[model samples]
Target: MPQATFQVDQEIYREKISTAIIRHNYPFMFVEHEGIRDLHSFLNPTVKPITRNTAKSDVLKLYKRERDKLKHVIESIPSRICLTSDLWSSIATDGYLALTAHYVDENWILQKKILSFHHMPPPHSGPILVEKRHLSLTDTLFCGGEFFHVRCGAHILNLIVQAGLKVIDEAVNKIRESVKYVRVSEGRKIKFAECIAQLSLSCSKKVCQDVPTRWNYTYLMIDGALMYRRAFDQLQLIDVHFKTCPSDDEWVKVENIAKFLKPFYDITTLFSGFHYPTANLYFHGVWKIQMLIKEEIRNSCDAISSMAKQMKEKFDKYWECYSVVLSFAIILDPRYKLQFVEFCFKKLYPATYVDRVKFIRDKLYMLFEEYMCLSSISTSNQSSVACASGGDNIGDEMDEFDIYESQHYGLTRNKSQLDLFLEEQKFDRKQDLDILTYWKANKLRYLELALMARDILSIPITTVASESAFSIGSQILNKYRSSIVPKNAEALLCTRDWLYEKGNIKFSNEDEEDEELAEDFESIITTLKNSSNDSHSSFS
Candidate 1:
């Protein structure tokens, strides 16, 4: 009977372990909550509930186990992996850096895995960041040196939109102040809602204050306020104290600004994807942005044309020379190879069109030659290994004779793999075409070139994946759990991501909803306080 009891207790402990992992529940959940502890006691009063410290240890053990498995998987991959990284600061002002690895697995599926999420000491310089991250300076891992560092495409778009926004700062400020007035007090919100009812306006979204740091918040505030424009106009008349209300001309300016920023907003959303290969899709979007800016420059409105000119200046600063890796990615897309790049560059850079295309072609050919040499070396090594293992004396004799004949006759193929691939017809199916599948299907035919394509296409165009790790980190290190040390924090965040990726658990939607709600409320309160201070200063 004692032995039977011991077996039952062991099963109970195993169940507790499984419960913690499957639910992603906090370590303290088991001991802090009376109901959970009571339930465990009822099952086996002799067995004590694990303490939070013990639970943390269990979590660390689990993380190490999963990390080892992941490391093994990463090591097994033949293609070079591309990485994206970003630095984030927590609520406590502790700096953390997240690094994410992107690669295509053997089955032609794109995989994104977070390699690290650790605290970085102060002074986050570029050299220090790379060194602390333990990434090699001269390897493919660092993209053959830092110049090849692919800045987050979404982040770049944000910078461009923010610069353009300076053109309509006064107009945006007015709209922001108006939204702040309505959102600041319950009484003002009720009054606005009443005005909406009176005006019979079909406003589904409430007035949301913008967070100055996030460009999307500005877009949302503008889009939402525009929906209740009529109600806001009515509120201006009813509430005599509503001094921040935007006038008709200001509203028109806001509408134009929203229209201008819509494309940028869409591009950010497009490039922030995690599951699919984005490098191939980047060239088209970037080219579209360039065209959009050019079109806006020719607009009849002075404000818009001026904004476009400033944006064009900023665009030229960043995209003066498109990164060669991006260009190579586009060239590999069979659908839009060298020809498409040549055409786009000629149109985008009419003055330096010849130089730009020549540079791209030259770089591409150089990369092709490098891949061919690597492939030849790999093939020769494999041949040597096979000959050694099989003890193929006859094959060795044949190889010697063949080499002598080749050297004497100078035999050569008419065209290389790169040439053959370039000569092939571009993929006819443009709609819903899978780039990975295309490469995988033709990998055997253009062996070396396909390997290069697989590596290049696996690279993510944005560091949003790393940014997303910070999002998960925020949830893990919430207010109540602020006491979690960086070590434990890393363990929890990395384990959570690993489990979620493996389909062992799902993150709660409520957590995300709560986070967004908190951000929105914080922005509203902060904006209200700033506006109130400004009003007081003006009156004084």
Candidate 2:
């Protein structure tokens, strides 16, 4: 009998290897690693080792194939999409632009997809950015790009908090220095642990140093230091060189500042959240944030009051008034509707609330009419192309309003869909309603208005989605990811996101380079060795 030989399907092997690379964000050179090759050979001698070049080619092919499928999906979906664009500059001065789309799918599930991850080579300026985006995506844009240029709400909130943090900088710096000093060496950390033990301090936390540019880290730095207060005080007594320990008075200020910042931190998390519909929540989030800052401005504590005044100044600078898109979003939300808009508008604009509310309501009606007219034109265009029963030429010669009035809504439809929506009793404020689900359930009742809701509700309150893409890009574009060409760079990033879309990618802004823990004090003290266990995991 002839010996039977086993053959490996090289095509399937290469594709699966390419997929693993993208899904796990492994470097392309991962295929060429000696251990990887050895493992593959031992598993099946028939399989051949592939080079990084082959891996790169495989990745590009996969990207192009999958991208076409996603494009088809986007076209078939009935919901109009909302986009977010973000720019990231690498350590090597390379600029990457990530554009993402958010919309409700046919099944009423909210979907977010990456549209482009382009390698932008340039002097990164507003005009250069605008020109590039215009040339590339102009034809595909919805509403003719009228509401496209949305500022990231989370980024603006960061600016406001960053400006506020400046007021308490002196106190923050002192606590920050103390954290840095202790984490410098294992000896210092051991000694610091002794101080905690000596004081019988029950705080199980360790001090965390802040990345000064990220306010969240500053908040964490303050929060953690506050826990180890007595230990830090104890460290000051023996670690004579640790002169940056905050004064008693300064400590009070730090405590108060952290207390004041807690709500801001929570609000940011709420705004930056990706899984839920944020557009409907946008109005309420900002309203609470502004309300908190306004109250703090009149705080009994002089330091807090002073800090809030500066924050308020910055807040007003950016959010003198809200956007029409945001206003439209909340109006579509059942929990708020036009009634809540009326209430909030009065608070936002006491003198001009009536006119402002009317202005927004009129715009909503006009927007619905725009959607109505477009729906008619689309039907007419399709009919003309298909040579349908009527062979209607009305779309070309008829005014758009005429199409809306004659076909969709006429005089008797007074108390328009918008009016009917507003007249209905609003959902109770305490109801736990997901806005997308609410609109999806009611989609048929108000046909044109539901189209508006589908688009408006899917709008992202923050550019955090694109920013998260940058975090993944930061890993892929780094030194250890091998020499990825610009085209391959986009392919790797975009493919990773598409392949792993089920598990949401979260990149925490926390600084882990200053880690001083992940060790048993008893063993590390005896061995005098460095230890680390956190795997740099992200929340799913």
- State which candidate has the highest TM-score: 2
Provide the TM-score for each candidate, comma-separated.
0.83, 0.84
RMSD per prediction, one decimal? 8.3, 7.1
* lDDT of each residue in 1-540, candidate 1, tens digit only: 122254346545844664464346455455647888777667666766666666777777777888999899899997878877788888877889987888888788888888888888888766654452344533544224533566667777888878887887887887888887877777786677667766666645656667777787788789888888887799889888988778888888788888988888887777874345458878878888999999999988777888889888888888766777877888888877878888898888889888888887777777777788787887998888887887778788988988987788765444777777777788763667788899999999889889888888887887766677777777777777776788878877787777675411223553454344322323444455587799999999
Please provide, for model 2 over 133-184, each residue's C-alpha lDDT reduced to its tens digit, 9 standing for 90 to 100: 6523655544555555666788888999998888777768888778888878
CA lDDT of every candidate: 0.75, 0.78
Task: Tell me the deviation in Å of residue 354 in model 2.
Answer: 1.9
Candidate 2's C-alpha lDDT?
0.78
Tell me the spans in candidate 1 whose CA falls farther than 4 Å from its real position. 1-32, 43-47, 130-147, 204-206, 274-277, 382-413, 428-430, 501-540
RMSD of 1: 8.3
The runs of at least 3 residues in candidate 2 whose Cα sits more than 4 Å from the true structure, single-residue gaps closed, are: 1-6, 130-145, 198-206, 274-277, 378-413, 508-540
